[model samples]
Target chain A: MEIKAIGCEPLSLKRVGIQDGHTLKVYQDTGGYVQLKKAFGMSPDEIIQHVKDSALRGRGGAGFPTGMKWSFVPKDSPKPKYIVCNADESEPGSFKDRYLLEYDPHALIEGMIIAGWALKASTGYIYFRGEYNYLIHIMDRALAEARDAGLLGKNIFGSGFDMDIHTHTGAGAYICGEETALLSSLEGFRGHPRMKPPFPAVEGLYACPTVVNNVETLTSIPQILEMGGIAWRDLGTEKSGGTKLWSISGHVKKPGVYELPMGYADMEKFIMEDCGGMLRDNKLKAVIPGGSSVYIMNAGQILGKNVTLDYEGIVEAGSMLGTGGMMVMDETVDVVETTKNLSEFYKHESCGWCTPCREGTDWLVKIFNRISVGEGRPEDAQLLLDICDNIEGKSFCPLGDAAAWPVQSAIKQFPDDFKKWLTKKANGNGIEANI
Target chain B: MAAATPTSYTDKVIVSDEVAEFSPEIIAEMNEHLAKYPPERKRSALIPILMLIIQRERGWVDNAGVNFLAKFLDLEVTDIWETATFYSMFNLRPVGRHHIQICKTLSCKIMGEPEITEHICSKLGIHPGETTEDGKFTVSLVECLGSCGTAPMMQIGYDFHEDLTIETVDQILDSLR
Candidate 1:
C-alpha cells in the first residue's frame, strides 16, 4: 500500500547532529540561530506581532495561542521579566520535547532568545523534568556553545539585544509543568501550583511579568520569524498555525515522532496509513487522543467520527489535542486495567499540595485497582465519577483535572467493561484475577 | 548460588568524606540545583535533593537520610518524607542496585504489562516490593516512566528500556549484571 505524506517536511533543524552532542557546528550548519539574528534586528513588539501573525498555539496541551500568551505579559511591568520554556514534558505519551532537547538543543536556545526578545526579558529558563538527565547534559553543552559563539548573553549577535538562557531541572513533579507551579519551582519553592487571575502573565517568576511557552511552541518561533508569519500561518488550520511534532506510539508499526501540519492530518489515516496500522494482526481497540490525561475514545467512536489531528477536532470530540500524543491500544487490551494503570500514575505523581488532588487521586487509584482485579462494586463507577468531579475544579492546578479526566472518561465510554468487573466480583473471583 | 555479603561503609571506598559525613554526592548535587533558584526559596530544591539521595543510595529514603536531608534544608522530617513519597521517583525503602521500575501506566498495561511484570518477578524470584538475595536486582512497580508508546517497558537507573518482552527483559537484566 502507498502512503501519502501530510504536514510539513521533517525539517532536520533540531536533529542535525543529534548523535554528536559535543559541537554546535552542525546546528550552525543547519542555519541554527539565524532566526535569532533576524529577530535581534526587530523590536520586541515586532517580534511579538510576528508570532501573533503566525497563529502559533501552545504545544503543551493547553493549545493557548502562543502570541496571545506573550501579549498577556504586562508591558508596563517593572524590570526583571522572564520567558520560560516549559521543557517539562511530563505528560504521559509525550516525548517530543525530549527529542527536541536532545537533538536540537540550540533550536530551543534560539527560540528562547526570540521569546526573550519579544517579552523584552533579559533572562530565560528551560524548566526540564528530572528524568531527562541525558537531555539536560545535551542542553548544557548547547548552552555553552551558544555562549562561546556570542549567540547568547549580553549584546547577542551585535544587535544590542542582550538575553541569557538558563536551564532548571524539575524534580519529578508533573504539576510543575503548570506555569505557576513551574515558577514556584524556579523560585526554589515546593512546586505547589499557585492560583490564576494573577496568572503567570501578570505576576510570574519572581513576581514579575512572564511568558511561559512549551518547548515546541518556542522552537517554531525561529522558523516563523525566518519564514515570515503569513507564510508560516498558511501551514495548519486558522487557529493553530505552523507545524507540530506528533508523538505517535503504542501498537503502531511506526511508533515515533512525525512532523505534520495541524488539521491537515486525520487520526485514523495517520494511525492506519502513516503508522502502518496496529502491530501485526492486532485490531485497534481504543485511543487516548491526546496524552493519558485526556478522555479515552472507543475504536468504534473514533471510526464513526471523522476527526482531524488538530486542536479544533479534538475539542469537538470532548478532548484536547494535548501535546499531540496519540497513544493507541489494541483489541487484546483490557479497559479496566488501562484505567487502573492511569489512576495509579495520577495517584503517584500527585504533589499533595491540593487536598482534592492528593487524596482523590489515591482513592481513585485504589478503587480502579480493585475494579481491575475483579473486586469491583456496582456503585464503584459512579463513585469514581464522584471522586473525579471533586478533583476536577477543586485542586490548585490542572494536575487534579489531568488525573481525574481519564478515569472518569474511561468509565463513561467503557461502562460495559467496568460492569464486567463487578459481575466477576459477584462470582467471587480473586482480586488479582485476569480479565 | 552463594549469597553476597552486604558491603560495609568502610569496606567500600567512600568517594568523598563529605559524602560520608553528609550522605554522598546527593547533597552537593542538590546544592548545585538549589543555586539555580534564589536563596530565599531554597525549599524548592527539596524534592530533587531527596530524589538524588534515594537514587545514589538505591531505593527509598530511610529515616536517617530523610532526617539528615530535613535538617540540611531546615525542613521537618515529615515534610521531607511527604515530598519523597509524593513522587514515584523517591523510594521509601531499600532496593537492589539496579532498581527495575516497570512502567505499569495505561498504555503499558494495554500492551500486556501483566505478563511482562510477572515475568520479571518470576525471573528475579521476588515480588514487586522484594529484592533478590544476591542484591543485584530489585523489582518495583512504578506508576509511569512517561514512555507509554513503548508500553510494557521498564526503567533501570536513568535509562528507559522500552518495547519489552520476556527475552528483552532477560537481556536487559543480564546486561546490567
Candidate 2:
C-alpha cells in the first residue's frame, strides 16, 4: 500500500500515508473534506475560474483542460446537470485509477462534491469499471461514511447546495471509458460511443448538460483548490500543470505507480533509477511510452532521446502520454507478437458501431496473428499500414484509431521483426519452424 | 425457482423456463440498491441486480434471471441481454465452480502469459474456453484485469493472483482442489 511521489510534493497520494487511509475518520484527520468547505464558501464561478487558472488537464488519456471542459456546460441549462466520474480504467496497462479508488475513495468523493458545485450538478455518478469489482465495496463504504457524517447528501457544509453521488458499475467494456459510451452504459444499455459535436458537456447523461471527469482528474480537484491555482500551475510544465502518476509495468525490475511532476527529466533515467531498470538485467527493446494504444518507441529512438514524462513530451516522441501507462519491453520480447496481442484486445473491446472499427480491428488482429505465427506474406506489412490508414479517422470513435496506432507504430519502428516473420515458416503449430 | 411459461412475444424471444424470484430478504437488499439512484433512473441498478441474479443462480446469468431482471428493473429482455453480453465478467451459461480467468492481453502476454495459459490448460485437461469434465474448474482467457504492474495474473472468481509462476499456478490449483 506504499505510494511513492518522487521529486514533487504529493497531493493525491498524501492521505494514503495515514492508517486506514480509505476510512472517513482517517481521511478527515488529515484535513480531508476541508477543500469542499473552502469550495462551498466560494462562488461556483470563482471555483471554475480558479480551476481554469490552474490549467489542470484531464488525466484520463485525453489531456483536455479540465476547467475548459467544465466551462462548456451551459450555466443556464434548465435540464438537470450531472457530474460523471469515469473510473473505467480499462486501458490495457493502466491501473492507477483503481489504486486511488481502492486506497483513497474519499478523495474522489470530496473532489466530486466540488466538481458538482462548480458545474451546478445536482447528481453525480462514479462509472466504475466491472473488472475492479472489489473497489465498488470500498467506494460504497466510503460514500456511506460521507453521508452519515454530513459530507454528502442535501445541504452539504450548510451551503444550501444539494449534491448526491452514486456509484455505477460498468460490466466489462473498454469502449465505455469513452465518455458518451460510459453515459450509454450508465443508462443501462450497450456501452457504445456516440458521435461528438453535441459533446458530453453540451448534452450528456440523460441528454442534460453534463460534465464528465476522470477519477484522477476529479481527485486532483481538492488539492488544486487547497494549493491555489497559480502555485499548482508552477508545479508541472507550462502547458501541463501538476504532478502526473506513471503506471510503469512490463519488464521492469520494480514495477509500480510513481507520481512525478510533469516534464520530469529523462524517460530512460526515470525507468532505470525509479523503476530499478529492466527485469532480469535484460536489454531494453522498446517502450510503449503510455498505455497499449499509444505508439511504440523503439530502443534506438529512446536510448539517447531527451524524452520527458508529459503530454507534449510523449507526443514529440511520436506517442501520446495515454493514461501514463508505460509498458517496458526487454530484448527477448517480440514486437510483432506484442502488437498482435494488443490488436486482439482492441478487436475484442470494439463496440461494433462502425464497419472500419468493427471489421478493421479484427483484420488487424488477423494480420498480426499471421505475422506472429510465421505465416506473414511479404506484402502483409504494407497491408497492415493500409488498413490502419483507413481505420485511423474513417471510423466512428477513437477506438478505431487506437486499434491502428500500435500496429502502425510497431511496423514503422521495428520492420525487421515483421520481415523475419515473413521469411520464416510455421509448421502446423503456431511456433516458428526453421527459424 | 418456479418454471416460467413463456408468453411468446416471438418464437425467437424465448426466455428461460425456470423464472427466478428473489426472496423477501433479497428483495429488500435490491430495494436498498435502488434507493441509491433517483426513482426514474431505477434502470441504473441493472448491473447490481444482474450481479445478484448471477450469484443466486449459481454462477451464470440464465434467461430466467434476465427475465426476472426485466420485470424487476422495468427494462426489456433485449436490454438485459445487451448489457450482460457486453460485459466480460458475466457468464451467460453455467460456469464451473471455480472459473480461472487468465489475462491474455498485451501487458500480461509480454510477461510470459502464453506459457502460463498452456500450463494451466494442460494441467486442468481443459482448453481456454472449456470447463473441466468434473465441472470443478473452467479456464477462460480474459482481457487485462488492470493488474498489469503485477503481470502474468489470473482471477479465480473475484480474487486476483498475480506475478504467477508455473509452480505458483500449480499451488493455486492444488489448493483449490
Candidate 3:
C-alpha cells in the first residue's frame, strides 16, 4: 500500500487506511451496510438501471457490463436463484482479487447482499481458489461477524430479504475462473467449463439462474449504489467507469498493487514514474500490458504511444485491458523463455476437458523445450504460431485463448527472439527440424 | 497448516483399498457442508469436505479417502477420482511434510525462480520432484499462485513465503523443522 503520490485515491482499497479494515466494526463505522437500506428500498429494476448508468464492467478479466449481466437472470425462473462471487485469483500476473478478499471482505459481502436484493437471490457463494486456502479464515470470520450482527441470513436489515453467503474452495484448477467452470467446481464436480448460450445467468449453481462476478466487480456494487451510477461512471473515462485495481509486477522498481481511476494516465508514465521505472534502471524491453493472458507489447508499442490504461485505450495500444495485471520486463529478461514459462503454466493448469487446451499446451511446451535446448528448427516459429492459431478459439473456454495469446503475440512482436533459440548448426544448414 | 496445498510426490499411480475413518466431530463438520447444498445433491459437498477433511485427517488424497467420500456422498468411485485427479492441489499420492511449491510461471521466472529452485534442491540434496533423505522436504515447481507482485514465492504447506532469496530460503527451511 506504500507508494509515492499517484494522483488518484483508490476507491476499492479505500478501507486500507483502517488498522483493522478486515473487521466488521471498522467496515460498519465507515458507512458500510447502509447501502443495503437504500438498495432494498428501490425496485430491482431501479437498482439495475443505476448500475447500467454506471457503465460498470466485470473486473474478472472480461469487461462485460455488470448491469447487463445481472438483468439476464430470468426473473420468472421456477428454481431458486443465487448470486456467486468469482474470487478465484489464479491468473498469472493478477492478484487484485486477493487484495480485496483479504483487506476488504465486508465490501464484497455487502456487494453480494445488494446483488441478492437485486436478483432476489436467497443464497450466495464466494469461490476462492485453492491456492488461497490459507486466507479462507479471514473471509469466514468476516461472514461470521456479519451473521452475528444479523447483517446476513434470515431477514437481513429487517426487510424480509433473506440472503446468505458461503465460501467454496477450488483445489487448483485455473479453468474454474471461467464462470461455467467455476459453477461446475462449486457443484462439487471437476472444474471443467460448460457450453455457452445457457450461460451462468440463465442456469448456474445447482442448475439455477446464477450471476458470477469477480471479487472486484462485486465489491464495486456498494460504491456504485452510494455515489449513484452516473457519478461513478464519470469518475473514470467515458467507456470505463470507476476506478480499477491493477496488479503491476516484474522488473519494476516498485512492484505492487495500485489503484487509480481508469485511464488516469498513460501506461508509459505509470510505468516510468508511478512504478519507479525499470528495475535497477535497466533498459525496458517487453511488457505484458494485462494479465499474462493478453497480447504482449514491446517497448515501441508502449514507451511513447500515449497508451492510456483503460479498456478502450489498451485496445488502442493493441492489447486488451485484461484484469489490469501489467507485467514489465527489462532488457535482462528473455522474451522466449518468459512466454515459455507461461505456456508451462497453461499446460500444468489446463483441466484436460478438451483436446486443444490439454494437448496443445503440452505440444507448445515440447516445442519450447526443443527450442530452449538448441534443437529448434527454422519452421518452429511458424509452427508455434500455427499451433496457437489452432488453439485460440477451439477449446471449451477461454483458457486455450489465454494459453495461446501471449505466445502468439510474443512471436508476432519478437520474431527474432524465438528464432534466436535455433541452434547455429540448424540455422546454417536450413534444417527442417522434426519434433 | 499448508499441509493441504499443491504438490505431488511421485509419478507412480497408487491406490489404497482401506477406507479412511473419521471422528464423529469430522462427520458433523462435513454434515454442515452438505447442508449448504440441496438434499439430493450430496456430491456438491465433496470438494469442500474433501478439502477440510483431507487436509487434517490425511496428508494426501489416497484411494481410501476417496472411497470414504464416495460412500459418504453416494457417488461412484469414478465420480470421485474424476474430480479429485482434475485439480493439482489434491495430491493423489503421499508427499513430504513440507510441500515447497515454488512458482515457476512468467513473473516469478523472470524474477529469479531458477536460482531459488537450484538453491533449495541442492540444499535438500534432492531434485524438483524428489523428497529429502529424511522426508522432511519436497520441492516442486508449481505454476503461479496469484502472488505476482512478490515474485519467486513458494507456498510451503499453506503459508506463502514470498520475495524468496537463497539466504531467506535457508532461514525459512532452517526454521521449518
Off by over 4 Å in 2: A425-435, B1-17, B55-58
lDDT for model 2: 0.85
Candidate 2 chain A lDDT trough over 10 residues, lowest sum: A426-435
Model 3 chain A scores worst on lDDT over the 10 consecutive residues at: A1-10
Task: State the displacement of the C-alpha of residue A365, model 2, in Å, after optimal TM-score superposition.
Answer: 1.6
> Would you estimate the TM-scores of all the predictions?
0.87, 0.95, 0.96
lDDT tens digits by residue: candidate 1, A273-365: 888888885889888878888888888767757788788888787777888887888887778777777787778778777799999998997
Q: lDDT at A211 for candidate 3?
A: 95
- Candidates' C-alpha lDDT: 0.76, 0.85, 0.86
Q: Residues A27-83, candidate 2: write the lDDT tens digits.
A: 988889999999988998898987888888998888899999999999888999999
lDDT of 1 by residue, B75-114 (tens): 7665665555545556555668887888776667767788
Docking class of 2: medium
Candidate 2 local lDDT, B24-122, one digit each (tens): 887888888788676998887888668744454545777777777888888888888877777777776677899999999888898889999999999
List clashing residue pairs in candidate 2: none
For the second chain of model 3, what is the TM-score against the true structure's chain B?
0.88
DockQ of each: 0.36, 0.68, 0.73
